[model samples]
Target chain A: MAAPESGDGNNGAARMVTLISSDNTRFEVEAAAASLSQTLQLTILDGGGGGGDGIPLPNVDSATLSKVLEYCIKHAPAAANGGAPNATAVDRAELERFDNEFVNIDQSVLYSLIMAAHNLEIEGLQSLVAKKVADMIKGKSPMEIRRTLGFPDPTPEEQAEMNAHMLEYGWAYE
Target chain B: MAELLRQEAVEKVAEIEAQDSEGVHQEDRLSELPDDILMCILDRLAVLRDVARTSVLSKRWRHVVGLLTEITLSAADFESPVNGSKPTFDVVVQSNMDMVKAVTSILAHTSRRTIELLSLRFYLRDESIDIFRSVDHTMQNREVVKASFAVFPEMRDMVCTDDDMVIYGRRFLSFFYNYPRVFGGLKFLYISCVRLGKFDIANIFSTSIELEYLCLNNCDCGIRSLLQIEHPQLMGLKIICCAFEKVELNWLPKLQLWTYDSWMNSEDRYPLSFGYVPQPCNLRLINTGTTLHKTIKLSDFLDNAIIRQLNLDFQSGSVGDLKTRK
Candidate 1:
């Protein structure tokens, strides 16, 4: 990749940053998109992720980092507009469509993205993934939720506790 | 002992982390997530019952229930009788009571965390008093930043007589009087199908000091009664299908949007007049039910007020008959 230009002072080109995953893979992206993460915003603001140096995220792996970056790139424009209060209906609808399709992935990938999002402190991505997981388990019984989330079969003690909880709060179950 | 259990959980999670590399049987990874991540997931499950059920997922998830900052309990969450079958009075009462019991049980786990939002939508009934008291108690202990309420009468608007609506309004006022702090802290409130008196309506506005948005659907005072609105923090107001003779927008400093739909009087060209509204930007006047034969003048209706965006929908296709000033 070419070295990012700096000190030119507003040459009308968007400044870029490099983010290194835990596996030491470098991915180049715009500073605005990477700044969507509260954790990365300060570093990007301080001119740390340009040129030869890159922000290394130790907790996020390569595959998950790519997925997280995709969300940040898509949401950066709207976020730059202070949530785009004056955005057209079509623009808002397109973002909604993109978000709904973005989180449609395998459970394992979804869990990885959730953790990466949590570690990176991306508020929008975190809420999107959490809403996806919540939709998966909404209106299900305790046992049903465990199975849906791929939890192992409850032990006898756990089963007894679940039963006791159900007995005490029968209204919730109903 | 609590520390020991946490240590055991961490060790168990570490073991699971090791197994994740094998590429076989990727179950139970969700439980291994940290408490904050788990709390984030549970926050979207606004229904407190669903959040409560997560406690049985494992020992670690039991405390996550208390950390939830947004809670919504609606009577519609409980199953009602079939549509064709007319539910008896007792069935309706029982359903309301069950919803209240669920709400009470959920509130029992308040960890004194600051709640960002607490919204409740329930049928107007005696059991609703229990919900009011529980929410008041929750407010007293914790700081609820934004609270919203949508109250509905047991009888539908079409079936209810004027007397029934008056009684429901009285019950709502009584609840408001009893829990003044809860109403005072509300940022958004929606009331439907209630016939409130002139003073009763004004009293609600006085107590709901922090209100930003207020929606009144299928509600009104007496026939063609002049109702005046004055609030300090209200930004949006919607009046839908109400039987008010005239509505006077009196002294709303922060009002930005007002939507008036289908007033009772068809003979009166304008059903609303403005007073001391400094910042209204959007005004929507919709009349989809009937046609106005007289030519409605927008200049006279708006008087000297300058609105940025005005939407007039006379679904009867009479936009041409309406007059506007240059």
Candidate 2:
């Protein structure tokens, strides 16, 4: 496999490789993509072996990781395209559209995205998904937020305390 | 039978559309989220006043606003301060003060644990001396009444700037004392003020053990220990136009990123520490009118941050270790 050419100044020349998760799962991606995570970059650099032999990701499951890769794949385009060239209104609109569509998925898919982004250190993807959740959460009722996010119902005493705390968050929906 | 079948099919379609996804994992859900994600979500969160209004509806999100590490207050967020001199700005000083008071009161009740980042951006038209005074007053009254010590364990970046009186010399000392642990673990902190005392530097910096990116903007600070970096995990530090008798670089064991500029002569220049991490995170130093008499010794090892570039600018000839500025 060809070592990926990193036009960006930061990571230098990184190679494309195959990564294997715990359940014999495999992902063929550019080394630059894996290097999005500082932890993986350092580990690969410090290890100093071709290790092109599919780096094993025992902690990550296949389904969750594929979702993370979807985020990574979408983000890979933005990264390759030079990430929001000149922050113009139209450019921002395009990015906003991309971000919205990128994160619009089942709650379970969103959850997996959040977790995998964290594990993989895809900061942009994580933020997009989080802002998506936050947007849905804002102006929503606690029960509604809980229901939307799949959180379990609160105990009675917990509810009372929560009600008291809610008195402090100043905004409301009519 | 045919009519019943049609109704059943439509009802089934309705149920599928109405179904929500609510069975996802919760533990480590927030913690495992990337830092930027947390920042974005917190960014969208409403003010404490707005958040409290939600408590009447349900229990889960009542304290969620309080749990947020980012607290932002716009001048428009509050009514003008009570009985204050009319400041000469679109944002009334009274409004700024009221917002500060309301935020501090909420901070008073917010959880002291795991509160890592606190950002206060004020459009102040007045000197921020009283804003600090009120915080001091809160500290004094803390023991007598309900008080919780602020433990910002995960605080990284703090931006306290804009039109205001809060960014002053002695004030940051109080800020340092009130939240010593916060700065100790920070990655980026930017503060702008008029003056900086010798004691504030000697005392406040003693507690910043793991600072990474630091920028001091136009503060008339003493330069006695301008490079007294003790941070074990520090990666970057930026100091601009500050007073310094000598530049002393000591024991920055893991420091990889450094930005320092001092106009004072070599007599005031402090020596660079030895055997510190040869790894270069990112190092940028600017020479004002004055140049270094000698290239103070850097530990024998080359900076090994595996960096793609090195930017160093000086007068006349180039130092062997320093690369081009461009």
Assess the local accuracy of residue A165 in candidate 1 as a C-alpha lDDT between 0 and 100. Answer: 72
Clashing pairs in 1: B224-B245
TM-score of 1: 0.69
What's the fnat for candidate 2, on a 0 to 1 scale?
0.24
For candidate 1, the per-residue lDDT at B170 reads 83
Determine which window of 10 residues in candidate 1 chain B has minimal summed lDDT: B12-21
TM (chain A), candidate 1: 0.90
When candidate 1 is compared with the true two-chain complex, its DockQ is 0.25
Q: Which candidate is the best by lDDT?
A: 1
Report i-RMS for every model: 8.6, 16.6
Model 1 lDDT at residue B285 = 88
Stretches off by above 4 angstroms in model 1 are A1-117, A120-136, A147-160, A167-169, B1-32, B44-49, B80-95, B266-270, B287-297, B313-326
